[model samples]
Target: STVLLTGANGFIAATILRKLLERGHTVVGTVRSESKATFLREQFKAAVDSDKLKFAVVDDITAPGAFDEVLRAYQFDAVLHTSSPFRYNITDIDEELLQPAIQGTTGILDSVNRVAPSVKRVVVTSSFASVVNRTKGTWPGKVYTEADWNPTTREEGLKDVGSGYYASKTLAEQAAWDFVKEKNPRFTLTTLCPPMVYGPPEQEVPSMVKLNVSNLDIYDIFNGASDPRYGVWVWIDVRDLAEAHVLAWCDAAIAANQRYIVSQGNFSPQMFVDYIWKHYPERAAAKGINKHSPGKYYSDEGIYGVDTSKSVKDLGMKYTPIEDMLRDTLKRFEDLEAEGK
Candidate 1:
């Protein structure tokens, strides 16, 4: 069965794509340019040459029925809609986050509705932002779950807490459900919600290993040292996330129409860093990074604990500890830089 993965080149989605390939699933992925086909081919040689992978350029997702033509030819069995604007900092929330997040989703759904009736399952990538309420402002608690929607997450509201990015996801997902309700669509919908996805490099994608989301605690994991949060806190591994998705695909008992918080155990980056530092002290000191720090650098206020029991017991998700993720992430980057050196 062919899987249609939008945002084929995205950081997180690529992990899903790699996992799909490993599972012997045909993947029809989207890229922004015809020129990228060669690069994708090179990167996905195993899948592409196996006659199980194909690529198409979806230059602008905002175009009405953007994916109809592609799906017209191939009957995709599943759709992994992972293309959403993800940026830590943004000034114009409307233009940067809302437009792409909303239109891109609706536009793809519009196409999917028209073309691929064969698609049975559609997994959309959402975020913890959509689940937990505004923390920087007013947070009810430090724990959240799939049952709760972010407090300010009105889905259809002016830029309040979510600004535009979160608004977009909340709205777009709402729209998807609404659309499904109206049409009684053939496909089942599930959303994968990840909170500060932290883990080691399962593959060579730079985004997978690099701490791209934060410098000084971007919702989870502190900077400079391993925080006590690592001992009791919760964090999601990208691998675990991928595993949960795969399990969702297979598990029939689980609710097909629902969201899952895809994370494992929470540990501080310091424990992970120190673990690696112990093994590679020379590597650490050479990098000129401050190796010593203390206290609860990773805080519940910074990163509220999330319950993934549903995703775990239902989808059978086993998350990777933060320590291994930290060491592996650092090692991967260190190796990458060394390659150039």
Candidate 2:
């Protein structure tokens, strides 16, 4: 099947791209930079040069039908919308975060509307951001599931309404669902939401540029900062997340406007620290840091967890065990330091 993935060369999306290639699907990924696309061509050269993979430049989402030219020309069978602006802090919050997120959804769906019959399914990389917030984002002590929405509307006040990224995603997802129901297009749409996603880097970007990463977020948990507004914890392996994307696209039963919480298990930063201390004592201590950061850092329980039952039940995806996934991730981080990539 011919597949199109927006934000093709991102951390998690790169994994999804690799999985799609392994399955023998024809892939054409959209990148904002032709130079980055050239790097992808080398990394996935066999696919790119062999005509199994292609790249298109799409620099703006607010551009009407940002992907229309490519979508119309290629006749893709599936589309994965994996690109979104991620920011911890935004000066012009609405433009940087909201515009791409909410507007990007509109643009992608517009392309689908333009080519509804040709596109079989569209998978959106959403977040648990759609479900809860950091402080009183949802409830004081609840594990968010597919049934829950952010519930933290504009009425809730922004002091502790969590990050702007949450606002962007929650609003964007709601808007997408509204559009899907109103239009009732032929294609199926599914949103895969994960939280606190942590894993090793997949590709090399400019060493000068640093994206706010999950691994570092976890590291911050060890430094004694806790947000007491949540209790449900959720984490997913990068590789497993890639595989789940495949299942989301290939499975017939997963359909339009459905949301799947694509998490493997739940863990607080404290518990995850303890987990590493027990399993990987040497590595943890070797980093010139305390191996355990339980009570000092996070609460015994926090609202960072999610229920993976729905994804497991419906998609038949078997998530990798937490220990193995973390072990490999840390090792890869060390390997990067060694190679200085």
lDDT (Cα atoms) of all candidates against the true structure: 0.66, 0.73
Taking the tens digit of each residue's C-alpha lDDT, what string does model 1 give over 37-155?
A: 66567878987877888988888877788888887879887788888877646776766677777788767776777778887888878777677565444232556778877655434
* Regions of model 2 farther than 4 Å from truth: 137-141, 154-162, 208-212, 218-232, 275-286, 292-305
What TM-score should be assigned to candidate 1?
Answer: 0.82
How high a TM-score does candidate 2 get?
0.87
User: How many clashes does each candidate structure show, in the order listed?
Assistant: 7, 11
Q: Which ten residues in a row have the lowest lDDT in candidate 2?
A: 221-230
